[model samples]
Every structure is written in C-alpha cells, then in structure tokens.
Target: MQNSYPNRQWIYVKRPEGRVGPEHYELREEVLVGNLAANEVIVRASIISVDPYIRIQQHERNTYDVPHPLGIVQRAGVVGQVVASASPLFAEGDWVSTYSGWQLYARCHHSELTKLDPSVAPVSTALGVLGMPGRTAWFGLMDAGRPRPGDTLVVSGAAGAVGSLVAQFGKRAGCRVVGIAGGPDKCKFLTDTLKLDEAVDYRAYSTLESLSDAIQAATGGVDVYFDNVGGRVTDAVIPLIKRRARIVICGAISQYDGGLDKPDLGPRFLQHMLFQRATIQGILARDFINRMDEMVATVAPWVRSGELHFHETYVDGFDELPAALNSLFDGRNLGKLLVRV
Candidate 1:
C-alpha cells in the first residue's frame, strides 16, 4: 500500500558559496520503484530537524560526516512512523528516528533506525531534547565544562537548542549561569524561561569592550564557557575568563556560513588562555554516543516534571527545510527548529 504514494525528496545540487538557499537544492518527486528488502522497513516522515550543522554538510568535502553527493537526499535527523515493513523488528505505526534526511518516506534496514516511544514524551523530541541536541548539552557540559557548584558558567548562543540545555545543566549543578544570545527577546527567554542567572544580548554591544563590561557586570567572571556561536562573542568572553577556566567549543555557527575561505581574523587570545590557565576543547556529539543513556536518565525526568522547559519553532511543509535551516544563521529560531511534513 505504501508503494502507491509518490516519494518527495530534497536533493543537494550544488555547494553553497555562503548561506545556503533553495537554489542549492532540487526537490524531486519519484514513485516508489521496488519492494522493501527482508531487513528493511519503510517510514513516513512526521517531523524533520533543520539544523545549523546541515550547512556544513553541504560542502563537497567535510571532516564531520561524509560529504553529501549531488542528486542525493540532504541528510538530517528525522522522526517518523513506519508505514510498511519487511523487517520483523518494526511493525506498521511504530515511531522511529533516523538520519534519513529531507524526504517524505525512507526505506532502510532496521539497524539504521532507533525506536521512539511517544508515551514518554513527544516523538519530535527524538530529534531535539531527548535526542542529539540534549545529549550534546549533557555530555559536553559534564565532560568538557565540568561545572562545580557556585562556579560561573557562561554559554554563547544560549537560546539555541544545545546552549539552552547547557545553561539549565549548570543551574542544576548549582552554578551561576549567564547566557549570551542575539536579541532582547532571546535574552529575555534565556533569563525568564530558561532561568539563567543572567542574559546578555550580544547584538546590543558593538565593541568587545562593551560586551566585556556586560559580562563583568553579570557574574564577575566566567569559570566555564560553553561556546556554541563563536567569533566576536568568544573574543569578548575571553577577556573575562576566571583562572583555570574551561571552554568547550561545541558549534561555531557564526563561522559556518561564509568564513571558510577567508576566516575572521580576531585579536590573539592565546595569551589570555595562557595567563588564565584556561583549557579549551572542541566536542562532537558522536564522540559521546555511549553516554546517551546516562544523559537520558538525568535529563528525561527534568523534562517530564517540567523542571526543564524546551521550546521549538515549527515550520510546516518539507519545502520549507531550506528556509528553516537558514533561520538558524539568521537568529530567527528560539529553540530547536523543526519542519513538520
């Protein structure tokens, strides 16, 4: 029965020069041409996650994952329902999550998918809080930042998917959390909704001196810095780092769009790191996949009990994936961004 429906997919067409647009992708509709193999199951997408990392994946060559090939579906994490199955592992109507990309239906072996239970939380969360973003926050904080009680923890891109959770984790660990976000509204959401100790609007300050002053006013100095959006915000925060500070480089969204060839040259801050005895480390979620169960055990309760609040910006339709992705670089998304198909 599922074979009767046309499959629509967004295929990568060209390498994005700077910011990716709809022109970089080609949406093609093709009829399902064959039956599922014995080990395969077919999934109908319900929600597709549009992330900043996808922009990096658009390059013809990348170190993070295999570079997407031309005319192939754009890769992304998706939450969907099984509609047809030759695999005994997944029956029709079961919810699953996979790296199936921007497509209406995906047929893959059962090993490629993770089963999700909607009864525990919204299945969409499999692509958000209870999924990679949440795990990124948990492991990156615990492993890289290593917050101590009463320590001043600061996070850039604080209103974002990973950054918001990192702020909450700091609060839970008895640290004073300060968030740096784009605008006044996002800054408000960080303080009022996410309950960070302080929030700084990076957009409000034009110079590094003024930004540093705001950080100094907030928590005196930062002991741990969870950096999601690097560049100017990082430059400002470096001057205010306390002794023996730990800086976790998670995602540099500020540089992901266009600065690959000619990188932003900023003031040399290695001296500050040397004098402060601060340590900086770059982290990838894939490195800590084994600890995902530990993260879920810790964060799932907070989510279920309403202690940890998560926000999501939903854009309807698969065609909006490019626009939804572009929103991340534009600071248009409040939290985890998703496209409901």
Candidate 2:
C-alpha cells in the first residue's frame, strides 16, 4: 500500500438560478496523507450517486430542509471499499456504503459506515435498489400510498428509481398500475419491463389538457397517485383521483431548478379532492430511516431473487458527477443515475 493516496473532490461552489451544470461546481485534487485516528476508516469511492434532491438542496429557499451549505464536498451517497482502517469493525478491502459525497476518498468514523456483504447482492445496489432509493420507494408507496387489491395506482415519473419501485410494489399489492414518464423508450420500459398496466408518455402531448386526457383515457379513475414529478405532470394527475384516493408526493423534479424558489401555481384542482374526499401527503426517506430493516427484509429478497427490476444508468468517470446531476432534469436516465468513480 502507498503512504499517500490521490484524492479528487467536486466542491459545490455556487447555487443555480435555473438549471444546474458544471459551472456550479469546482473540482480540486490533493494527496491524502495516511494518518487515521482510532476507530476511523478511509474508504475509496467506487460509485457515487447523483440524485434530484441534490438540486433541491441548492435552492436558497428551504424545501424539505435548509439549503446545502456551499463551499463543501457535494453531499451524496457513495459505495466504496475500505483502503485503510483503525476501526476493529472494518478492515482493508471490505465494501461499505456511506454518505461521503462526491470525493474519491473519505475518512469516516466506524458508526458512519455500513458494512456491506457483496455475496448478498452487488455492492452497487447499496446505492440503488437496496439503498436509499429502495427505502424511499417502499415506505413511500406502502405507507403513504396505502395501495390495496383492485385499486388503480397511477405513478408519475414511473421510469425513474423511486417511481419504478413504487410501480412494481403497487403491482405486487394487486393494484392495476399506470405509469407516466417522458419519451417513448421509457414508456415501453414501464409497460414491457416493469409490466405496468398502462404507460403514458407525457412528452407525446404538448398541452396539459391533452396529457390529462391521455391519463384519464388509460385510467378511468386513480385510486392511488404516487407522484414523483410535479408541475404539469402533477397537474394532470391531481384532477383524476377517485373517491377516498390517496396521493403520495415523493418528489417534484420539474420544480427543482427555479420553480421551487418561485413556484408556478397552475390551475386549481383542489375541488377534485374536495369532491372525492381524497388525501394528499408528502413523504421523505428520512422519515422512515428508523424502519430501514423492514423495507430491506421485504424488498431485498425480491431483488436477490430477480423478481424485482432495478435499473441503473451509470456515467463513467468522476468528472461527470455535476453533468450527471444536470442530466436528471433532461430525463435522460431510465432509473437511478450514478457516477462511476
């Protein structure tokens, strides 16, 4: 082993007014001197996640939480191997997951690391299916969506990570699933691979009225709406809820750029909720962090057995982190988007 390791990091330098891009970040390289305190471990990042929430946090205004403090490493989920450790629980060459952000290497405390067993599933899954995205989809759907047999479940952003899992979970719950995504290829993925009962391509319709009609045509009425994308897509789904419908707001990717700061309050559809006695609730992954085992126990088996489909789009190289995050708004990724370190 070398006495020092080369480390590179993407620092979040500026907040974006509209779309996020490379301009918002600064990449710096340094040599990490091998000096570890007791119970400390140094892990070399192999995979890094670029998610929508990172964009949301960039906004000066608070959404789910306060804005991410600038001039620091872009915070994210990373899967890596321990290169050096003074901790008794971890050793050299052990795979682990940590919230160590967009850095080639991280020095973390023993408790900050989650030891991963690669034999159970691919270590990469710790950032995808069996990780935060999986947890978000599981609890967000089952708890907040409260799907039942024979119910009609409509999922927006259905081709993406959390949305895709919610769609499948709805299917497993015996609900007829209708997925809404942009583009034809993602729509086909929703129907052919995810086996959703119907897949509506929002991009096919230029107007909200047309999109609403398409959604209504596919689903007579929505008993449960698992919404991941807000803006026009959400506007279409809101008015289609059935009696006693449950709406789970997992995300609003369309608004993450600038809409969050100055939201466009579109046409009013709360009357639909009033007529149907529908309930709308917002959920976050952190809310269910305590019950992570419950989510893993149920979802991990299906993942390991190949019963559940977890698609991931990987961008090669650490330099692509900012670009990968920016690409999320363009709807370029079919599922969880990650950067290979």
Candidate 3:
C-alpha cells in the first residue's frame, strides 16, 4: 500500500464490442509509488473529460486514434490540482490542463499542464469553453466553415459539447446559425436556449427530402455546414449547399460504431465541390498552435463577461466512467461531460 497516497487508474482493457462497453475498460487500484523528476508536477485530478471521440480509439485506428498504443488509460484532456511540483511555474494548489486521460492521479512534466489564469474563467472551462473544444469551435468556424456575415451556417451535433459553443460564436460573428440535432430535447435546447435561427430534429425527418425541406425553409441555402456526426447527414447536406459553400469536417461520431466501411457518397457530390468551388476540411484543434494564447485571450473575456455560456454534465463517481462515456455518444449529455474524480 502507498504510505501516504493511494494510486488508482483506468486502462483500456480490450477492443470494444462494436463501440465501447464497461468490459472494454478496467480500473485498478494500487499503491502510489513514484518519484517526480526535476521540473515535473503530480496532479491529483479534479475533473475528467468524457468525450465522444474517445469511442474511436480502442484498437488500431486511423484519423483521431493516431497510433496511441492500446492498454494506456484512454486518452482524454483533464483539469486538475497540483499535489506536488518541481518547477517554479507551478506550486501546490495550482490548477492546470493536460492530456492526462481517465485516471485519479496524473504526473506530468511542468509544461504539460498549462497554468490556468484564475481571473479569466473557471478551471473546468479549461477543458470545455476556454479549452480545446472551445478553440475547436472558434477555429473550425473561421478557418473551415467560413461563415460570412448574413451567411447561413448549419451545424450538426448542434447542441452537444462543441456544437453549442460553435452556434453561439457563429451568431456573434453575425451569421444565421441553423442546428441539426438527434432528438427533440436537443433541438429544443439548441433553438430555444441557444437561440439558433432554426433547429431541425434529425429524428423527425428521416428522409433526405424532408430534412432538406427543413433546411431549405430555415435559411434558404446553407453557406456552411459544420459536421460533427457524419454519414447520411453529410450526404444529405451535400446537395443543399449554395455556391462557394464551406464544409468543416470536424468529427464523425456516427461512423465510429459503423467502422471504416462508412457509406460512400454519390460521385456528383465531388462534382458539386468542383462546380460550386466549395471547400471541405478536417480540423485537428492543435494545428492552430501559434494562436492558442490569442484565442484564449479573446474567448476568456467573453466567458468572464457571461457573453459565453457553458453547460457541463457531471457524473459523480469515478467508477461510473463507462456510463458517463455512454451518455456522451448516446447524446444523453447536453453539453460537456465530466467525471468528478
């Protein structure tokens, strides 16, 4: 047993069944026995992020999985408190952000956990609104989606973690944002709460014709489509784009379960891209490395001013990880999902 501390962690156990299951992950408790090297910090996790994209990385994976050898705790960025430090930048009680995965304790090099500005935003926001997801929203819209003022922006996964913030940012930039979500509650939250120009329930309109009609009625033509869950939804949106439209391919959570044999789109879709002079891109948020400090500076004020709003779904127990992760992919989470460690 650890003399003064208990060490515990969750590791990816087996290739998931279809998507993921409790059996896919195994949490083991052990004694804390480690020494921090110079310029390292020991972080006792405060909140753990449970994101939908985590579903895709169980085995040999392309795209987001990125060859992270299996058996490590699933990769997730976390916010935590410094329990011990070996560098001048951090001391006890400091809060920081790092890709610490789903574990109770994380030992990180000093630079791994970026010191959070206490006056700017909540520490939890570092994992959501003021963090990667937020920057994902900010850059994806401006860089790939390219929502010009008065242009119509369509966002899928439109009420979940990244989508909600994207919608708000689109509105602030003077674009009319239309949202497409999986169900009625999400639709309501997006349209009624976030005040999107229109919100379509993907469940209500099963056919492409009806879904297109809903989009057509919303803003006449889509100037930008921010895709989160791919497959049919994207196939449907491809035909409805206006000239010079931009499609931001962020994540395809829908296809993670369906595997690599995802549905192929019509040949005419590629022809449309050429004919309309459109653009499509896959964004990894880390690519905007040069602008992170500036991005945080810009968004932090909005968060502090309450111009930006964030909702987090909290699961109270560390052992409830599987269920919490289930809530993420199933659209049970309204905004960000965090396991309170």
Candidate 4:
C-alpha cells in the first residue's frame, strides 16, 4: 500500500433550514498521517450509508441524535477493510462496520468496530440488511409491533431499507403484509420482489381520503402499522387501524424535508388510539444493540437461502454523499441508498 494519500471527507458546513442540499456539506482533503496507537487501526472505507436520519441529526433542534456541528466529518455508518492494525482483535484485510462517516479512510479504536464475516453475506450487507437498517426492522417490527398470525400488517415507505424488511418479517410471521411506496416501480418491487401480499402506490392517490380508501381495501384494517413515512401516509393509516393495533414509529421521512419547525396541522389521531386501545411505540435500533446477534442468526440464514431480499442504490464516489441523501427525500431511491467510496 502507498505510505499515504489525501483523506477526502465531507464536512458539515451549515445547518439546513428546510431541505438539505450539497451546500450543507463541503468536501475537504487532508493528509492522512499513517500512524496507529496500540488499539487503533486505519480503515479504507468501501461503502458509506446516506440515510434520512442523517438529515434529522443535522438539524439545530433534534432529539434522536446529537446535533451535527459545522466543520466536522459528517457521521455515518460505513463498511471498510482494515488496512493497518495495532490491535490483536483485527488484522490487515479484515472487513469491519463502524460509524466512520463520509470519509475515504478512518482511524478508529478496535473496540469501536464490528468485524464483518464476508463468508456469511456480502460485506455491503453489513451496512444494509445485516447492519443497522436490518436490526431496526427486526427489533422495531418483532419487538415493538409484534404482528401475529392472521394479522394484517401495513408499512409506510415499505420500499425503504427498514420498511422492506419489516414487511418481509410480517409475512414470515403469517400476517397479510401490505406495503406503501411512492411510485409504481417501487410498489411493484414491494409486491413482486419483496413478496408482500399487497402494495399501495401513495402517489396514485391525490387525497388522504383516497389513500385511506386504498389502504382500507388492501387489508381490511391494519393490525400492525410499521410506519416509516409520516405526514399524510400516517394520517391516512390512522383511521384504518383496527382495535388493539400496534403502531411502530421507525422513522418520519416525510417530515424531514420540512424540518421540525413546520407545525403539523393534521387531525388529532391520538384520539383514534384512545378509542381503539391501540399501542404506539417509537423504536431505535441502538436501544436493542444487545439482541443484534440474535437478529443476525435469525435473519442471515433467510438472506443466505434467498428467502429474504435486499436492494441497494449505489451512488459512486465519496463526493456524491449529498446527492445520495437528497434522493431519499425525493423518493428517487428504491432501496437502501449507499455511497460507494
């Protein structure tokens, strides 16, 4: 390997007001001083994730994650190969997953990384199906939503990384799974590829009433609602929830583009929850970190055997991170969006 190279990184330049753009981040380069401490390793990033949560994290007022500061390497989930190691836990050429951000290379402690076994699945799966997104779907749906046999499960943003797996898990549990996505192609993939029982095209319906009508027809009434997109989709699904329904709030991608400042004028759907005695819960994968191994054991086999399906949209180059993230809000990406570094 070369002694050193320019470490290109995307730095947070400004707090986004409404929609995030390339202007919010700046690509900067610095010399990577190739040196390691006793417990440190230098990793060359292969893939970096660009997720909706990153937008929320960049906001000035955020609850889920620490607000991103300006002039810092933009934090993200990454899969990379260890190029140099000073720790016994890792060796040169070992694949690992970590929060190494949007940089081409990272220097991290051995303890901070999870070694990836390429024999189990592709290393890129560590950032998508087998990594945080997969864990989010597993714990959020199974633990929080808790769909049962004969139940009707409905997922918003069902073509997305977390929602896609949530739909599959619901199906595996014998629930009638219905997915909601933006375009016809995504809706088709949800049904044809993901094997969902039904797919709802949200873009086809111009009004909430129409959307609700379509959802109501698809699955009599949702017994488990795994919500990824909030706003109108949530509004449409609210009234259709059956008695004793479980609503899992995994993400609110629809509201991210507008930021948290814009007041939501939607009806008080909490009233519906009170009447139906439904359960609503918000989930974060980090909260269930201890159970990740169990999740991998359960889901990995299905993935390996071709029972579980995963899709990824790869935007090549380290500088494309901004455009990759923006694609999420526009519903341009059909699956987990990653930047190939």
Model 4 — TM-score against the truth? 0.98
Can you give the TM-score per candidate against the true fold? 0.97, 0.98, 0.94, 0.98
User: Which candidate do you rate higher for TM-score, 2 or 4?
Assistant: 2
Give residue 59's error in model 3 in angstroms: 4.0
The positional error of residue 92 in candidate 2, measured at the CA in angstroms, is: 0.6
- Candidate 2's C-alpha runs over 4 A off are none
Highest-scoring model, lDDT? 2
Candidate 1 lDDT by residue in tens digits, 1-341? 33655899999898887889898889899876438778798889999998888887776667487776778898999999998988888999999999999999888899999999888888988888899999999999989999999999999999999998899989999999999999999999998898898999999999999998998899798899999988999999988898999999999899888775457898899998999999999998888899888888888888888889889889999899977887789986888999999
Q: What's model 2's TM-score?
A: 0.98
Error of 2 at 6 (Å): 0.9
The Cα local distance difference test for each model comes to: 0.89, 0.93, 0.81, 0.90
Tell me how far the alpha carbon of residue 245 in candidate 2 is from the true structure, in angstroms, after superposition.
0.4
Report the Cα lDDT for residue 58, model 3: 56
Total backbone clashes of model 3? 0
Position 148, candidate 4: lDDT: 95
Q: Whose TM-score is greatest here?
A: 2
Least lDDT summed over 10 consecutive residues: which range in candidate 3?
A: 258-267
| Candidate numbers sorted by TM-score from highest down | 2, 4, 1, 3
Ranking by lDDT: 2, 4, 1, 3
Q: Point out the worst 10-residue segment of candidate 1 by lDDT.
A: 59-68
Find the number of clashing residue pairs for candidate 4: 0
- When 1 and 3 are scored with TM-score, the better candidate is 1
